[model samples]
Structure formats: structure tokens, C-alpha cells
Target: MMNCIEAHGLTKQFAGRLALNNVDLTVGSGRIVGIMGPNGAGKTTLLKAILGLTPFGGELKVLGRDPWVSRDALMNDVSFVADVAVLPRWMRVSQAIDYMNGVHPKFERAMAEGFLSKTTIGREQKVSQLSKGMVAQLHLALAMAIDAKLLVLDEPTLGLDIAYRTQFFESLLHDYYDKARTVIVSTHDIDELQHVLTDAVFMDGGRVVFSCDMTDFDAHFHEVAVKPSDHELARTLNPLHERHSFDRSVFLYRNADVEKLATLGEIRTPRLSEVYLATISNQTLAQKGSPK
Candidate 1:
């Protein structure tokens, strides 16, 4: 597959401290990859670097052209919906649609308006008057209408409620994702987006600590529960992470025979949130995933 976005030896500095250190990433065409990390983990920094919103040290290519030097040309084929609900406040929804049409050659005005109808937004309403979730929906609808080869979304569902967030991603997959296009999403809602994510990247303190295909997410992590009596036995297996409920405790472990787990109670697939806790633990980082 062709690379839609590539970063090599990327580094960024803030007050003499490194935000990103020799970071490298490859996003192939037509893949929905998620960049996951805690707050202040350089997730937005990487997006900004890719969007040419900030100057950073390294090589970046979007659609085979340098993003920093080729921002104008690159933006013609790349679109972004940042985490911030920063729609044009004074513009009416219709006016914003019109502006998008004028700026993006392939903007689909009709589709955008149609998509907006799925929400409660009135076409005549000013952006400033819309609620936060409404703003997210508006941006989502507009981004979906772009015919860009690459779409970069930062915290794409930030203010959305459950229904809108669910509908937004479904619409994104149906309308925007295709073999010739790419979608890169940054979000904290791992559980919601896990289903559609093709790959996952975990960053910390401006550096990538974990990168893996999401298909392997289910393969490598397992969620299990054990009876109080079997707690010591479960711990002996070196569970990746563990938590306690009332009478039973939950754990995330790697390939600890299910037969052995039968004594522990119910075993199930660890959710994205559970996997996150297991993999992103302080001990895991300090011991296994260290460049710190």
C-alpha cells in the first residue's frame, strides 16, 4: 500500500525539553489508525506537525510531499478536524457550509447538509449558539464531506454524546474510508473507537511507546476474573493488570490457559479500556517499554 503520511526522525522542542524525540510513523492509504495516549502525551503535537501548524525537526511527507514546505498543496488533498470546537462563531451553519465549499474543491455541500440533518442543528443557527456536542457534529459532518485523500482528526468526538459519537464514527467509516483514502483519528475514547481502529499508537511525554495493529489487540490481551481464593494463583501468572470487584477480581493477562481460569470464574475479552490500563501501567513502562 502507498504511504499517505510518513514521518522520519521527527523531533519537537518546548522550552528546551523534547516533546517528540526521533519519532517515526507510517500511515498507509485507506487505513483507520488511532493515535492513543494520555493527556500531554504529544498526541496533538504530532498532528500539528503533520498539519504544518508547528515547526519541528524531522522529515514529514504527506501524500509524498513535504508537509511543512508543501502545506498549501498538501492541504488541497488533506483535511483536518481538530479537537477544539473552533467553528467560525459568527457564521451561520449555512454560511460555514458555503465557506467550506469555496475552500475545498471537492467539498460535498449537499451531503454535508444532509448529514447535519441527522443532528439537531438548524442551518440558520450561528456556530456560536450551538452546544459543544452540536459543534462536534457540525465539524464531523463537514469533514465527512471533504474528498481529501487523507483526513486527520484530533479528539474528533470530544464533546459528542454517546449517540452522536456512535453515529459519527459509523458515518465516517461509511462515507470517508476507502482503499484510496486514509483516516487518522486521535481520541481518548478508546472503547468506542476500538471497533473501527485498524492500528493503534500509544505515546507518552512526546514519544511513542507502543505501536501495534489493532487486530492484535484482542489477540494479545485477555480479561479474566478469579475467585478470592484463587487470587494468589492468578498473581503468580504475572497478570498484566488487575482490579478487584466485590467478590471477584478482574485481570488482564497473556495466554494464561482458559482451563486454568475456569476455577477463577468468568473470563472474557478485555475491553479497550482494560487493555489500555494493562499495557499503559507505570510498571510496564518503567520496565518493558523504556527509552525514558
Candidate 2:
């Protein structure tokens, strides 16, 4: 598969503070990649770099073109829905469609209208009058209507209800996704998107701590739940992270002997959220060193 995005030694700064620190990432085409991170973790910065909205040091390319130099050209084959607020409040639904049709060469008028027809949003209704969820629906309609090879979404469902959030992703999966296209979603809702994501990228403190295919997760990580009596035996194996749960202890192991761990307790595949927490916590612990 061809790479949709490539970055090497990518670094970004804000007012002399590093926002992206020597990041190297490659996103292959036709995959649903979830960029998971907390606030100020360079998630938005990386997206901005890919979209050519910010200046950075290092080689960065999206769709094989330098984003900073060919942003306008790159946008022809790329589409993004950053936030619900991206649409103007005074614009009516019809006007938004007209504007997109007029400006974007790849806009598909019938497809966009087809998506809107299923929603409560009406052509005459102004953006300000619609509910948050309705606005998000409109944004998704517009974004999905574009025949772009790459789609970038930055918290596209923020401030929406659970139903809307669920609808947003379902729509993307069923209506928009195809093997010829790639989608990158930056979100804090890891568990909700875990099933849809083919790959996961975890970033913390302005750096990417882990990036791997979801299929490889089991090979590199494992979670074991043991009785309190087995805690000492489990500790001897040097688990990456451990915490108490109910009356038992849960340990997260990285590249450890899974067969050996099985004897200690019940072993199961860790959720994406658990793996993210373990990875970030371990990085912090290593940086802090053993408590003296």
C-alpha cells in the first residue's frame, strides 16, 4: 500500500516551546488511523502540519507533496472537518452547499444533498438555529461528499451527544470509507473508536510514544489479573504497570512471557485505553527514575 502521509524528524515550536519533538510517522493509505492523545500532546499540531496550516522544521509530506509548499494543490485531493464551529453561523444549509460546490472542485452536490436529506437539517435553516448534533451532521455531509483521497478529522464530534457521536462514526464507516481512501481521526474517545481503527498512534508530552497496527497489539502487550496472593510472584516478572482493581491486582506486561503469566492468573487482551494508559505511565516512570 502507498503511504498517504510521511514525516521525518518533524519538529514544531510555539513561542520557543517545542510542540512536536523530532517526530517520525508514516500513515499508509486505506487505513483508519486514530491519533490518541490528551490536550497539548501535539495531536492538533501534527494535523496542522499535515494540512499545511502551520510551519515546522523537518520533512513533511501529505499525498507525496510537501504540505507547506503545495497546500492548495494538496487540498484538491484532501478534505478535513476540524470542528462543528468551522461552518459559519449566518450561512444557511443551502448556502453552505452552494459555497462548497463553488469553491471545491471535488465537491459532489448530489451526494452532499443525499446525505443531508436523511437529517432534520433543512436547506433554509441557518447554522445558528440547528442543534449541535445537527451542525455536526451537516459538517459530515459536506466532508464525505468530497472525493478526496485523504480525510482528516480533529474532534469532529466534540460537544455532541452519545447518539450523534455514534452516528458520526457509523456514517463514516458505511458511507465514506473505501480501500482507496485514508482517514485520520484525532480524538480522546479511544474506546469508542477502537473497533473502527486499523492502526493506533499514542502521543504524549509532544512526542509519539507508540504507533502500531491494532493486530500487533497482542504480540507486544498483555494484561493479567491475579489474586492478591499471587502479587509477589507477578512482580518478579517486572510488569510495566500495575494497579489495584476490586479485590485483585491487574498488571500490564510489555513483551513479557505470556505463557508464564497465564499460570499466575487470568490473562486477557487489554483494551486500547488500558494500553494507552500503561504506555504513557511507563514513560513517565522511566523519566522520573526509581523513587529514592
The weakest ten consecutive residues by lDDT in model 2 span 283-292
Q: What would the per-residue lDDT of candidate 1 be over residues 168-210, giving only the tens digit for each residue?
A: 7888888668878888989999989888998888887777777
Tens digits of per-residue lDDT, candidate 2, 1-292, equal 6699999999999988889999999989998899988789999999999999999999998999999898999999999998788889999999999999999999999999999999989999999999999999999999999999999999898888899999999999999999999999999888899889989999987899998798677787788988999999999998878988899989988888988999998888778899888888887877789675
Error of 2 at 80 (Å): 0.5
Model 2 segments beyond 4 Å from truth? Answer: 290-292
58: Cα error in model 1, Å = 2.5
> What TM-score do all the candidates reach, one by one?
0.87, 0.95
RMSD of each: 2.9, 1.8
Model 1, residue 181: what's the lDDT?
Answer: 83
